[model samples]
Target: MKKRINNHQRSTIKKVMNYIRRYWGYLGMSIVLAAVTVALTLYLPVLTGRAVDLILEKGVVDFAGILAILKKMAVIILLTAAAQWIMNACNNKITYNIIRDIRKEAFEKIERLPLKYIDGHSCGEIVSRVIADVDQFADGLLMGFTQFFTGIVTILGTLIFMLTISVKITVAVVVITPVSLLVASFIAKKTFSMFKLQSETRGEQTAFIEEMIGNQKVVQAFSHEDEALEKFDEINGRLQKCSLRAIFFSSITNPATRFVNSLVYAVVGVVGAFTAIAGGISVGQLSALLSYANQYTKPFNEISGVVTELQNALACAARVFELMEEPSEVPDAPDAVNLEEADGHVALEHVSFSYVPEQKLIEDFNLSVKPGQRVAIVGPTGCGKTTLINLLMRFYDTNSGTIRVSGVPVNDMTRKSLRNNYGMVLQETWLRSGTIRDNIVMGKPDATDEEVIAAAKASHAHSFIKRLPHGYDTVMAEDGGNLSQGQKQLLCITRVMLCLPPMLILDEATSSIDTRTEIKIQEAFAKMMKGRTSFIVAHRLSTIQEADIILVMKDGHIIEQGRHEELLAKKGFYANLYESQFVNTSSQA
Candidate 1:
């Protein structure tokens, strides 16, 4: 497992490097400026030591010479600061640009991903990958470029200067430095898994919150508030524990490395004093060597701190990469043809399908509808009615056999072109946060206002819409929260009415509306269905009495089929279903 994790981390790092390569100009400039800054910083101590030596040699202050050297050092320090500022600016540009591209690609990946992937993952988890994880990755890269680059340069440059002063002291510093490295490595190894766990728990918590908020009405309706709170607390407690472990380990790395660095500094100071007194090295050289020793150890402390952050960032990156790596939907065949001007003829030949391999939901499903025919399908729950619609729309391809529109196999036609011929309104209405007019025109983007209002009126939606605050221009809340369920359903139907495709599939589309409103909508539907191929999945048997053909399904097979009157006359499955519904309606009345 550890090896596999390391491989994933390495792959993510390589991908990040490829993004960096695109902005090589900015990176190259930042590197050059960082090097210049480090050089100037190291030279400042040398200049100070030289000034001290001049005063010691003469045993009298050379004020003019001292003043000139001090001035030069100040100028160099200012230039170093300026270069550091420019380097940081460049680093920010590179970091954010790469982050933008990463986010763009991740979103595009979501667009191309199959419905299967979306169905299996929680919305909050995917959202975390795109937003939170990407943000963390960007921040880490910014710190790495700004601090990591300069820290390494400072360490190497200071070591070189120390070596020129005295090889013995430099060797001691090098030997002691490894202790800090070992401590950082040990802490990082212990804490990396903790950070990864924390990230996972955080995503879980986020997902739970999103689910709860989305279904808050359901929870309240069922008086499940206490249960919801308990579940949230459990998830929150797990996240807190994971976070504490990660923070505890990360916090120890810096101070532990700093303690070892202090020991190195003490050794350097003591050894330099002895050498200076023994006439092995000058006082001025000793001063410079001491400064270099401090500079050399500083990077170790800074790097140790950054290692903790980088580990957490890598954990976030791993999650984002996991999302990006999911298998996308299969591409269309090379010779796929366009489904132009469909004649509304649909057929399913020996079609078989399953959401999972072990549990088949549709099997040997065969159906044929001539042009301009109205068909209604009725079945018990879990009898594959909706699954049939899914297969027809090519949202999920059949496991075997063929579904064809106008005698052309669905797989042989481009999915976009094939779907364009059908307009669908589902039981669960979906509306975005937009004006009423915008939602209605979604299916027909270039639709005129007059056409949109006309469609709304036909669906019996225009009257209520006009009573809203802004009429057709009224803006809806997310998922049409401001509208009643029935109103939302009407808008969905209005959207389909605007599209006016050659074929229609209505899956309990009028389930939310009252009987009176439903009757009105049904009257409109009757006229609309005249010249179109329509498939209705209805639970209320009365709605389909006028349908040209009715299919009664059970256990993934069509057990009965005929006109509603014919099926009733057969006294079989369809007759039993109709009688049950009729008796239930009578009881309710």
Candidate 2:
């Protein structure tokens, strides 16, 4: 079931509560412990009043009675501390466990999200929601559970205890405390919007930092350091402005409520003194009333601080929930069939699409390939060569029309199944932080050691692997940053070689390799694609000369199609493109 939360406080609160409800047993125990702690804490003041009564006159004091009261006070104090400690432990467990679940769910959501969503957002912004935002939320929620829960209980307990001592004094304290509420509420409203802006600016700053750090080499290469710093300063300045405003607004809450609290305390002291002098209450009773009044007002100070923090937490939680609740890639049909084996007859008909509605990229695009044809797609940049392959793999569904594999509409097949039948080697390689063998076995984890070595040899990567200290077992730096670009591309090819799927999509797969290795890889690919369907997207026209069919694409349309010789014979766009590459190469030579 797809669950969406409306952008309203009530709905957000409801969702937060739903998470808490999962750990209700611990929450219930924490609340019960809080109540017990408050009860003992409130009673200790009463015992102190009793001890004071016994010692009003030094010579007339009943030492035995005073001693008994002191002992009781000590026990109550100990129990109160114990209960509070236990409650805090429970709060930490609940808060962090919820954080763990939220992060897990957020990552799983990222996996299922459409490519359009991933393409639209910055990596650091998404990371902020999962890591920084969730951590902030956990801190605020822990505060709410630890102090906010017990603070309210303490306030209520003190009120009841105060009323028992003298209703007039209690009434006086009550009348003055609402002023604290008014102050806190006013500050809280202003802080919420300020904190929301602060959270957003923080995400932008994080994204900018990640971008600059990840591409530091490029920034240095093009002498973009100064410009990048100026941009960074601009973002940093905005973040500082938002953070200062949020802090300024929320900082007023505690002191404003504290001032009102002092007023309540002043009233209690003055009223209780009058009551003591008038015999309306004994000296000891008046002292207890004053203690209860302080206790009652203390919660306002704590809760005001909590409310300010909760505003920021709520803002962060909103971002995390938005990420988790985003509609995932359109789900496959309930009865979607899995293509265990495919003969690789692929077709696209009347395909029209665009990243944005106002601009079209591919329109009325049509293509058909037989079971074992080797098709090469050549195009200038932004002519929809890669986009066509993305469509074929169902990365982004076409705006209109249908793509099919083995005569089955892709929509009717499970994405995993459709992707499983095709081995893809993109120009941009991805390698995780693991052994070389691990990266190679990503497509076929259960492949035997011999299979892995054979694939590496076929892709000309075996010699490099042998030279490494630990061969295939050596772990890689993140994304294989330790290897040369050509070496990385070879490993990517090695990975696909192991998969040996019925179909293949090689998008500039050999663009990074040297000419010497390129020939070796071409020979390997030729043998590999002998009886399987293949789609090769390339810019170097010479590399694909032997392809069975050449598709020359321009402006999302196939302007020329035939064998390399036939296309050159026509002297069209393909002829000029093929000829221009050699002209540039000869000039460079």
Candidate 3:
């Protein structure tokens, strides 16, 4: 089992450290340059002491020498400042590259994931994992590594200079350092836990918002406004509480560091007073030591602040890693073979399947469709019509059966190559926030304008599309909100037709359309399915009557399988279903 460091601070720190290793050259150079800059800064205050002591005691100050010393120091300061800038730029460049790579990999992984994985996670959560989590790593790198490296280097250099000036004062400063660190470490540990809670709460809040917004129509239809608001408020309240606690712990760091430094300063002041009175230390050296002490403690305080932030960042990194480590649903098997041009044949032999364990939906199912044959599945709700299609597409593997396409087991074929042989129009149409042209071309990215228009015409969508404000260029909002449900479904049909795959799967394709649109759509569909192996899941029996083979399904079994006339003559399930519709029509009349 992998140990999960859920704390943002800890996860951020670890990721930053990992990045240092990833870009070791940049990290090493940055550290070295920063150390030199800090060493120069500490050197200046000591130089000031020497110049002051000489001017006070000599009675005859060398004016030319003083001018030369000042000029040399100025040049050194400028050079060191430039070096520090270069080091920081390098760190930023490396960090940006690393973040870009992470984002790309996460997105690529998502593309290859199985449909079950998509079904299990919300769109918002998946988006957050890729976008927000990678951003956390970038921010963490800046806070945990670059700033931290410079602060530590400067603090160490300042301490060394102080020790050379006066061992007693250096020891006094060092004594307070451990106590400050201990306090900071304790606070950081607590902050880490709080940050983890904060991140989890945020994820929940995002999930809630996405769910409510995505089902806004359903919520309104069911009059669930109060219920939705109450649920959102609960998540928001939890997020606020966790965020406050994390921030509170972070806030204590600076004060705690400053308080310890203040005590150290008081002790140093008493020691300086006694030393100056006894003539054991000069005013110039005392002044320089005081300045160096401030330099040393300043970075120490900064380190404490950085540690707090690092803890939070680490917590975020841990969450991101969890996403990265999720077992991929479409992991490729070794030596997987690519599927070439398929012959449009499909077979499911003794197949058994379940969406989740212990909830078996299909058992010992057998299906075979020859080249260019059309099969229609008619069933009541939850009779596994969609599940059959899922198995054919290899979205979920059969537990105890072999599914083959063109005589090759689906599992043996590369996922991309296998999917290329088939085109699908889902029960629920999904449209991107783009023009009608864009959505149509999604099925075939390289499709020409004429090709897209032809596909739309074939799906009976062109006439309606032409009436839009800008026709093919008319942009749609999220999920094509500007279009009616039937229009959306027709657009999906256009998309699939554009692909021109050898096999087609239509899951409740005409369910959303009105009678007039359905007639037009059915005409288009009939033309589209000509000489193609196709599976249609239909609620309306009339649509399947002309199918080459009709399978009436119930409880994951084919209760009736035959041509329209054959099944009607038997006076079984199909006949009873046909009679029930007639009885409803008579009652309504």
Candidate 4:
């Protein structure tokens, strides 16, 4: 399992590198500049030591020589500073551009993903990957690269300079350097799993928060506030534990590496003092060697600190890659053609489907509807009513057999073209944060202002809309939070009315509205369905009483099919359902 995880991490790293490859030229330039900066910095100690020697020679200060060396050193320092600034600018540009591309790709992947994938994952978790995780990845990369390139050059250049002065001191420095790296590596290994768990828990906590807040009304209605709080506490506690564990492990890396670095510096100083006394190296060379020793060990401390951040970034990247790797919706068929003018004739033959293969939701379903027919489906909540709509709309293809629209198999037509022929108004109304006019015109983007008002009037939404502060131009809050539920439904209905596609689907579209408003909307629907094939899925028997055909379903099969009055006369499942609702309504009255 550990090997498999390592392999997966390696794959994710390679994917990120591909994005980095796009800005290779800029990255290369940054590295070159960083190297030059480090080289200039390394030369400064040599000049300082030489100046010290010049001032000490024969106990007489050579002021003129020292001044010349100081001027040259100042020039080097200025150039180093300039190069460092330009290098940082390049690093920032590269980091931000790569993150921008990553965000763009992640969002586009969400668009192409199958509905099943979206339904199976929490919305908050998905959002966390696209926003929070990606943001963390970008920040880590920025720090990691900034330290990594310069630290490497400093370590290598310092070691080479030290070797030229005295191999004995250089050998001692090398022996102690491994201790710092080993300490960093061990702590990093221990913290990797902790950070991974923390990231996962954080996503779960975010998802719970999103779910709870979005359904606040339901919680209040059912008096579930205490339960919600308890659940939130449980998730929050888990996240705290994971975070503490990760932070504890990561906090040890820097101090431990720094301790090892200090040991190397002290040993080099002591050994170089002895070598200088023996005349094996000059005072100037001894001073330069001491400075080089610090430079050599300092990168290890910086690198150790960065290891913790990079580990956290890796965990976040793994999650983002996992989402991107999920299979997208099956591609359109190579020879698929556009559905230009559908005739509103639909047929299903030997069709079967299931959300999970082990649990069949629809099996051997067969149906045929002619143009201009209205078919109403009535069933228990779990008895394949909405599943049939999913199949017709190709949200999920049938597991076996085929569905045809106007004598052409659905699979043979492009999904966009196939869906364009149908307009749907679902029980759960949806409105984005936009003007009332924007919401109404979504069904037909190029719709005229006059046409939008006509649809709103037909759906009984005009009066309330006119009362808003800006009428049609009023901006809505997220999900139309400012509007009442019934009013939101009216807006949704108006959207469909504006489009008036060849095929119409009403999935309990009026469930949230009052009885009077429902009647008005039904009258409008009656007019709209005049020359279109309509499918109505409803639990209220009164709504489908006038349907041309009513199909009663149970256990994934159609148990009865006939006109509503005819089914009532037969006293079967449909009759029982109609009688129960009627009795409930009469009692309430």
Predict model 1's lDDT versus the native.
0.91
TM-score of each: 0.97, 0.97, 0.92, 0.97
Clashes of each: 0, 0, 16, 0
Error in Å for residue 409 of model 3:
1.4
lDDT of 4 by residue, 1-589 (tens): 7777678667878998998999999999999998999999999988988887886757699999999999999899999999999999999999999889988989999999999999899999999998888888888899888998999999999988888889999989988787888889888877777878898998998899999999999999999999999999999999999999999999988889878888988998899999999999889888898889888888888888788988888888888888888899998999998999799999999999999999988899999999999999998989999989999999998899899999999999999988889989999999999999999998689999999999999999999999999999999999999999999999999999998899999999999999998998999999999989999999888888888989899989999999987998999988889878997779989
**C-alpha lDDT (0 to 100) for residue 318 of candidate 3:** 70
Q: Deviation in angstroms for 52 in model 2?
A: 0.9
- Candidate 2 residue 161 Cα shift, in angstroms, is 0.2
* lDDT, candidate 1, at 92: 95
- What residue runs in model 3 are displaced by over 4 Å at the alpha carbon? 1-16, 54-73, 333-335
Tens-digit per-residue lDDT, 1-589, candidate 3: 0225334344555655675578888877888888887878888887777766767555688677678778878988898889878888988978887777767767777776767778988877777666666676578667655678778887778778777777887787787779888988788777877877787777777777888888999999999999999998988888899999999989998998899878777777788768878887888788887777677777768888888776666676677767666677856578887887789999889999888878878999998999988899987889999889888887888888899899988888887788888889888899999999999998688999899988988888999999999999999999999999989999999999899899988888888888988898888788878989999888778888888999999988999998989999999998888777776778899
Q: For each candidate, C-alpha RMSD in Å?
A: 1.7, 2.5, 2.8, 1.5
List where candidate 4 sits over 4 angstroms from the true fold. Answer: 57-59, 587-589
Clashing residue pairs found in predicted model 1? none
Candidate 4 positional error at 26, Å: 1.1
For residues 247-271, could you state the per-residue lDDT of candidate 2 as single tens digits?
A: 9988888888888888888888888
Let me know the TM-score candidate 2 reaches against the reference structure.
Answer: 0.97
